[model samples]
Target chain A: MAQMADKGETFPATVENRGGTGRIVLCCEHASNHFPAGWGDLGLSAEQRLAHIAWDPGALALSRRLSASLKAPLVHAPVSRLIYDLNRPPFSAGAMPARSEIHDVPGNATISAQERAARMRAIYLPFHTALHDLLAERMALGLDPVLVTVHSFTPLYFGKRREVEFGVIHDDDPSLARAIVKAAASTGLRTGLNEPYSAGDGVTHTLKLQATPYGLPHAMLEIRNDLIHDDQSVARMAELLTPVLNMGLAEIQRQAKAS
Target chain B: MAQMADKGETFPATVENRGGTGRIVLCCEHASNHFPAGWGDLGLSAEQRLAHIAWDPGALALSRRLSASLKAPLVHAPVSRLIYDLNRPPFSAGAMPARSEIHDVPGNATISAQERAARMRAIYLPFHTALHDLLAERMALGLDPVLVTVHSFTPLYFGKRREVEFGVIHDDDPSLARAIVKAAASTGLRTGLNEPYSAGDGVTHTLKLQATPYGLPHAMLEIRNDLIHDDQSVARMAELLTPVLNMGLAEIQRQAKAS
Candidate 1:
């Protein structure tokens, strides 16, 4: 509540299904492109504001569906990644990037250090700290939480088409990701291990920061944006990915027990 | 002392001429190329370690000379800028850059959020906080401290030779910078206003952060590295710049009194 007052009308993040008994902790870092009342479109055109550069299109809807079906807790950022990317560490340039693809974020171009620090305190720190605390609480309760961040990538990057429909990305430990990749074989969906983006691309910051340090099983699920643009598609995709996620979770549990 | 033990032998920053009785505060953000005990060259070759990318070649010596000549206090970072650039906010990518020009910093490429935060606490925050506190102390003493950051740039960048020998860069207000430029006309040295680099290049962070909000007069001095690479040259450059700096300070003081 104090955080809301600190930065006017911005909520750092929201958590739904917090009491869910599932081990999976779903994260949607780039869930919305909603600019808070004070931050005036960040000098973006209407088309640019709705672009994937602002936030991942259809990511929140799909994440909500997955949260429901998996009965898992969902932690999602409520503002545009343009304001502060929850996935990136505050030290990273990408966290408050001045430019993304072809769009120049006029507002971010010359942000003073004090303003930058304010946003970090108001948004980035609260979001990650809350998630970290939630994970710790679950671990204390004898629940081994699996970090599964959901995202949607543009079907075309730099004007080139991306063929991989589903990306199961991992960093450091790969057991959960490998399991997910294997589970995808039954559905005949086009799945790739760390496709479109990889750990080397600095896309796995959330996993590396929150999950790897705890040695918890984790995987970042990146679906092609075009595939989940509408409600029907989002629901269908969630339905398809649900069993695969369950299988992966079961396999990781079995492996953990064996070890 | 606790800071050294916490990070295994890294001094966050050092304050020289701390009790100097002058209204000017000198800062050298990239003062050393000394990587502390544990950081291990940040995965660079011997030549790359000594390159301008690691640290400003003779900026510290110049800053020290100016500190003595002008009776101003100086605050400087002791570790390499490659570890953490003190002039940048922690959120900016350049603060702990993964790459500098053609050099790839292997150590910075995959830094975790925790590690980034640790470096900020160890390096960036301490340096800036010390400078901030010093300014506050000066103001409390009725000493209207003027912020002057000293830095040096490479002679050749991306295989192209730079022509500007002296650069007076500013942001928001250019009164002090203009005075310095006006004073430079008496000397035969070639000078440019916001040349080589400018506020657009994100080089004025120190001025904007430390001085602008308080309406303190500030200017960042950029010397071509070749001019100040050795002791004799550093002393000579300092001598030439001190009068110009003094004149600028006098002119700003007159303007301040008039207002």
Candidate 2:
């Protein structure tokens, strides 16, 4: 399945260290803003495509650092969420949104049902199935795997500026998020528990669909895009985050053992 | 779209009095459990297909009666919820369930992303789009609609008997559910607020996606299937619910005006 990286392959997601046997599986769901071949520009100008509406600019770099730091396997969706939002439940109005922020997605505004289905078949289900199978294999080996999907958000939305820097998002299970938020506070970062977004905001699809059903401890990490906009900043942000995440996981495992 | 019911049409949803100018719109997302043409029986035994897992047995008939009683347009998905689950955001595991209750859906257990997309194009999206369009038209006409989606639950699940005869479910908005619960108190029937299922059960997609976004006052009614299993019982259930719903709506309007 890792051969999915070949240029001709239609599967929209990619896996790094596909055979890595690790306890924490890190995924950068909005890792890239690469527009697919046929869907030209999604009816957006070049400037708009480069905006937060396309992908989380620094999420991939942070995920790479965490993957290395935690020695965990990393999975990524390289396509722009604008084409197929990996985080949204399929066929949702937000799935192929006609509008994001102030810009209208003209390509998505009036697609026929058949066309939307084609996008899902080509991009969505496979990406999720890959991650699902990866986690299943680990669970089959009697391993307790923890999942953390990486994302980033704009500092300002609509017109208001958002204050939360590190957003710890979760679905029904908030154990992992609780641990992460506690550890981050010790590291002197502004963190919000379920701030900016939660499972209610049509976010947390990956965790809800893939992790909660299996009873796996999972959480979503949302970084402010401004924090990791450049290479050096991304590396610095990663340096601050990698150890915090490791500490959080250790705390969770310790609590689990004590219980 | 009203012609969606014509014999030659491939779409499996039906609309009743699609042009009705009433202030309430009724939708039965799981009105039928008829298996689709190619997805044969979803690997279920004949008995299983005829059972509660296939569809809410008494829901459609009750919806029909309510549509008439309220003089509101009624819309339904004639294909089984098992096909694409019009009520679920597509891509959800339950949307094209590989399992229902204790029975495994062998046919759905393994399907290509391409095939899932085809099902969505042919059946899923059209059905929702039809309903969306119906409600949108009413809104365009400056009509304030209160929505009530009808469904039924098995009296027993996983060998446990569920005592609540009626469940009033909602998303973030609790105004309508609150009103319905208050009105039902006088009827001397067991009613649970968000019982049997809730927004957490992934059961509130229609309300959350369709109703909540538009600020429409909506509630999902889940009756115990056994209570309305037969024709006389179905009529009786409608007789009991129709006025109660009207009363609830009046209460909501009254409450809104008071505020």
Candidate 3:
């Protein structure tokens, strides 16, 4: 898996799978928390820098730990989110954000059509291809893998405070979300059912394009940034969420058999 | 359509279709012939530089002419093929060509994931979305449009010359290809039966992905670059092709009625 950094230098992208028997594929779309060298700060202060707008901070650590603990394959994008957001549909208006928040993306403005095609060929296609290949391979091997995408949300957005500590988002398959919501409730943690964003808007990628098309059970877990700001917090959240994920997977299997 | 170019500069990469009624959707994946400013001249002499590798050479002009004459909506990519070959599958090995012929594409050597995703979003997706939207609109209006992709291929590749003046390539829809071949034969032009390339392999893109899924009749028209080098030639070819295409469309209608 560590070879991805080196391979990424030569190839456009890489997908790594740690050894696992469980049929749960883990993905972190905005995993990279590093900007390219010499980008010389995005012209934002330190506090303003670490917010959700910049990157999906701390989710990578939790995803890595979860992948290790569960022995499942993990697919992550190594580039900074500011460059291109993988979660947004390739044709979405927000795909190439010229001006994000108060900061202007100077690199993206006035790009030629050729330059745009080059970017898509190199990054977006590879990531989606890897995910597609992995799912196809697992399914071919008779493994009905459940996809779980890990992400983090900011405590506040646009000067408004967000009270949700955790969110369970699903567009089609409600089995996993229902399990997680129930588990979180039993643990006394207030969970939001698609609080930050609703899956009903028809704006989706990765999970929607890859998983939903196959009718596979999947869920997007959004943990508030404040909840996973540090290593200890990340580990604690992983531990807390582990059982919920496991139970959800088991219930998915049970439901699949029942149907 | 004129409104599009003016608005495109301000809202670049936005996609809108020409409102239409014809039951034929024209697509030109490699429509734009552009190179980034200052590409060190690609190290090729003028003759080799002007070859089909730089672009599809004359496809966009022909497609526009066909769209106008046939009153069919056309969906085209505004980016250079060198940036990302829109005709190739997003994840196909050739999606981002590192080297074309002997000319080295220096800019493509080490693209970051972020830059790649940006390209997919900015160019590839918009082209496909435009085509998909046009098809969906036609379907909604109860128009069973046959997809006709217009492309121009080089007269020769490597060292051998291609004798065929035109090729009608189709995979599952042999009915359309058979009709076009018969029509072209009736005109006494030497046509290649999937010459230059085969639909069985090395053939994919929006046409296959978008059209085949809907079971719509589709065929790709590959005219040798030598045949369509000038405006007169393109007009001549389009004139010859209109009857052939119409014959194929009629055959498809017959098949639909029979089924």
Candidate 4:
């Protein structure tokens, strides 16, 4: 067991895996707000630098806790989503956004065609390849892989306060999502079937590419960032989510075998 | 008739008109291949920097001569097409191309949504707004405006040599296009009525946004760079094109009067 999977920060997008034999794979694509210092904070003010436009604040921390709890491998992107959103496809406009909410990214204001291709090669391709390779290796080893991407959303968007605390996002597969939502409801979490963000809004790039093609049991969790901001809260949330995920996967397998 | 039109490079895209009372308006959107100094030459080698990938070579030079003879307004984008193609809409992938032919733009490789919006605000929107305002202002003054965009293409693309020396591109406007094609063919020039590129291929963002919505007589002229790579070639080509454009506009006007 390789303890951790760090493909390096130079490539921007990287993964840190706590080596485990579990079939559940946890992915945190927007895991950090660390843009390589070469970008000069992406020409953002200090306030904007720490804003949700840069990264989902508590997602990585929560995913780490869950990964540890479930004994699952976590593949994460180390660069800021402001640098390149790993959750978006190379052709997606949001993959390399020019604006998010009210803030603007000045560094990407006027780029050349050559510069675009370089980022695709350096950050985007590497991160996706690593995830794909990891999943492929597990399948080759005769282990079933369940894909789960951990995410956190802002409680407010465009000045509108969001209502749901937990969102179960999926692509064409509803078994895992429905199960997680059902269990989370029992835990008293204000759960949404696909509220806050829908998979149709082009938010499922990672899951669509990695999970749908393989027909793997997959679901992306969008927790409210405010709830998981602290370490204790993250751990507590993980504890609540771990049992749900395990049960959800067990049910999926049971149904698969029955079918 | 005013003699010259050059709006400078500070705002990047601006209108320079000779203040001619004629209905014809000239534009050279991919006019310059001059990417500003800050982006580290977009990670392109010196050779690649000067190639057609940076800008449509000879397009601006030819436009200058055409503007001189036509005595019409010429709107231009001073930044390199490699930076942000002014001929394309902000949402178009080619607007900030990550890849151009075999060359890739490193600067645009990993842009943020903020960056995309910045480019739109800084480069894309400004150019379109200026052009739109120019047309609106002319119409406001009770003057009919005929839009004409100037462009140049490579003789060889992807290792294959091309035959057409000129392409008259249009956006659903057949009157001006038919006139230009007939006039161009009469001059012993090998002309293609929308060859190498078609307006349907998303290449007519300028004409679509500026021309079609207004039902103005408009057409895009695509000259071969090999045919106008230098001062002598540019002058000769301009000399051949001037009378054709004047005659084309006259025919359009005549047809309008009859219809």
Candidate 5:
């Protein structure tokens, strides 16, 4: 990954396994908890900044393991979701949320329109544009890749505990998600289809914006953060998911060929 | 004004007083309660469709009077807010609200990504483009026009009575809003600065998105629906506010010259 030191931040977004020949294109939108130089913690305490609200803990690690296991290209954001939630479109309040869950983000409360646009220019646009270009390049190379985004959610949300371990969420098209669910049925992991969070929760924006337009099969994988807290657990989760993703891909390909 | 009946709706956005010479550009975003042919009432009853939830009552009439009174151009959305709230940026939940106040919009609950983009293309884009082109043309003609968006709110919100009849709301720059409040002081109108709804309420999206980038003086004028329920009242309200608006514009210009 190349870092632009002059931009006051690391790489806006980074690509790993760029030459991977797998039929899957991976995205990890909440990869980093970095606040950059000028943003100044977003009026958040150090603990709060490091909390799940800043970034998905271990999500980048899990995504990296998956990228290696699936031999897929991975694109990830390099700043905190507090800076700009990459999944949310520009101008949506959630894009630069003033509040998230139980915590108040004082820094985001009074952003000017010009500043909003500037954040989009510096962060959101570059990341999405890079992913779009990669997708286009893959299409040009006749890869016909399936889009799969990796994310992690906190086990306790607003003091409530979540029992679901894995979620396969879809926006409109559920082909890949269904296939993954079917493939995951053999495993002991408690997987739910459109569960924990659904498209109705506006979590599938990445799938909707990037994949639906191109008719690419897409799904968002949300792992409960407790399951992948450590490097070993992340690797184990990747090991468990890798084969299921492969089988899902195989099943979809088989169906496509049959049709 | 032009109508594209072939597209199964009226004019996506209508512009009045296109050749007006005033240095103010007025916008009525919630100008219509029209649900296009395909979107059947958004699963709302006839009464609910006609209610303020669908569109701001009497806002267009007041805007038209102001357009004539000030000899300023007016650009307005021609579809119900149920289809797409022109004031909200695309992808926002409020753009195609699943619920407004006590009403649940069954039709908008599970929109596909393609459908969302389609609505943006059909409604939001055309409206904004028309307004943007108008502003660009005005700038080209050396008229540094002020933007004034007209809207009307229900007197009762969520069963709570709102006493403020007029709200001069701003996003960041409060110059125009402050000026309007100052000018409205002489009138008997119950005016409030950023009252009823403020920038924090996400009510100033039009001003933020359309005007802020160009450094245009902008403010949103919100009138209580009870005061402008009839055409006569709308005309009278327009008459009362017309001079206030003129005085506000004069004050801003005078301040500008003094600076």
Candidate 6:
């Protein structure tokens, strides 16, 4: 019940606020970069800690901007990615990240069962529980909230340079993805279809487990990490994305109403 | 921060700890016999509240017994089924019951977005967050805890009497379901295939979200409501399930190691 920020924390793993009267609910699963005290910098140098492994650097900023512009409620996880990756299922090999690239996570290995549960209860559950509650509240009000997950993908994985400017990945709700892609292309930004990661990959959470189940109009919007590393770039991306998202949301609403 | 039950009114929900080494976790999403704190006995006499609409009457008892016998942790949501079904997705219409058999949920009509999110955040999130944390902790300790979800079904639904004595349901993990069926049949109990519900129903949560993602062995064991209505019957059901679950866990471990 203590405000995480009051403890001098950087960002709460989960935060929810009404954006506007619109029926869209925004979520950023990997939104923070601060680890709790005592994890001891994840056994990495400061520079290494700031790398993609620690957090999705630009996502939180973009999500904040989107939340402000779209006037939709935004919910995000606050703990550092190093503590526990909220996006990954708790059991995935990547969830605890025994190893990331060349860095070995000393604190993550051989964690006690109690410790694992503690972290999950502390971080993962609160974030998701908040999101679920927010969505449920929206629905109970006779409003269907379109789920928009904001994320940033590193421009490169391993050592290869990627070329996707933007990507829309989805498993079952291709309609929303298609609309976003088409809307973005109309604006001259090249979009990738499931580039960086595929929804088919079993490694997804929020979307598959939460969104798809409710048949909510949802999309996993992946912006190149390089493009969102700074505030200006993040703003630019959000600017371009606002209309696309609006278009998609409107279309989905039209379909829902017609049906 | 504060204990929910200590609030004096039982928080209208309950949390049950089925004692175990915390190696295996069990959950019953629909495990309460409640009707909003105010409905003055829910517009029906005491007999009506006792119906399946108010709670999965037989589930909590069986879940408690299973958790105790197997030394597994059990997490049950303590709200009335009529308030918000935890098993149903937050955005799904099924979440707020409009009508159930003979009685209607009077307090559930015309809820607002904020109120809906509050209920979801308050109840559903806490229950799942605990489960997620438990599983994460076990994995961190290098122990793959199997998740067993327990529930009970009425002998009839919408007006038909069910005939099966037991049901083992799974989405992609047929091996565990098959093993349980074989184990149960070996003891001469008549088991049904995905009876009462189907893995494909899109509403069942435990198996699809938790079990499937963790790649942990799981089975949704459904016993007829009448079959396990009391402690003695719950204990007997647990006695019959222990060997089957042990076998399933062993097979899962062996297969996990082999792969």
Q: Write the per-residue lDDT of candidate 3 for residues B1-259, one digit (tens) a residue.
A: 0011121221122232376456778888776655433233334455644667667778877887777767778887665676667676544435556677656665666554444444444455566655655564454334667788888887767767878878888755577777788788866667877776776566645555567545577888888888788899888878888777777778778877999
Question: What digit string (tens of lDDT, one per residue) describes model 1 on residues A1-259?
Answer: 1112345443657999998889999999999898876666778888998999999998999999999999999999988999888776554668778999877998788775556555666676567666765775565344678999999999878888888999999987899999999999988889999887889888887887677645679999999999899999999999999999999999998998999
lDDT of 6 at B40: 36
The better candidate by DockQ, 2 or 4, is 2
Overall lDDT per candidate, in order of appearance: 0.83, 0.79, 0.67, 0.76, 0.83, 0.71
Measured with C-alpha atoms, the lDDT of residue A203 in candidate 3 is 31
Candidate 2, residues B206-255, lDDT tens digits: the string is 77656764568999999999989889999999899888898899999998
Please write out the lDDT profile of model 6 over residues B73-182, one tens digit for every residue: 88787776666677776665566566776566655555555555555556655666666656656665566677777888788787777888889888767777777777
Indicate the residue-level lDDT of A254 in model 5: 92
Worst 10 residues of 3 chain B by lDDT: B1-10
Ranking by lDDT: 5, 1, 2, 4, 6, 3
Q: For every candidate, what share of the true interface contacts is present? A: 0.00, 0.00, 0.00, 0.00, 0.00, 0.54
DockQ of candidate 4, scored on C-alphas against the true complex (2 decimals): 0.01
Tens-digit lDDT track of model 1 for B197-220: 898888887776667645579999
Off by over 4 Å in 6: A1-11, A14-19, A35-37, A77-79, A96-99, A102-122, A200-203, A257-259, B1-13, B102-123, B156-159, B200-203, B229-232
In terms of docking quality, model 3 is incorrect
What fraction of the native alpha-carbon contacts across the interface, defined at 8 angstroms, is recovered by model 3? 0.00
TM-score of 2: 0.53
Candidate 5 per-residue C-alpha lDDT over B146-253 given as tens digits, one digit per residue, 9 for 90 to 100: 899999999989999999999999876799899999999998999999998898888887886667645589999999999999988988899899999999999899
Of the two candidates 1 and 3, the one with more favorable lDDT, higher being better, is 1
TM-score of the B chain in model 5?
A: 0.95
Q: What TM-score should be assigned to candidate 5? A: 0.52
Across A53-81, the per-residue lDDT of candidate 6 in tens digits comes to 78778998998888888888888877667
Q: Give the poorly placed runs of model 2, Cα more than 4 Å off.
A: A1-259, B1-12
Off by over 4 Å in 1: A1-259, B1-10
Question: Could you give the candidate ranking by TM-score, starting with the highest?
Answer: 6, 2, 3, 5, 1, 4
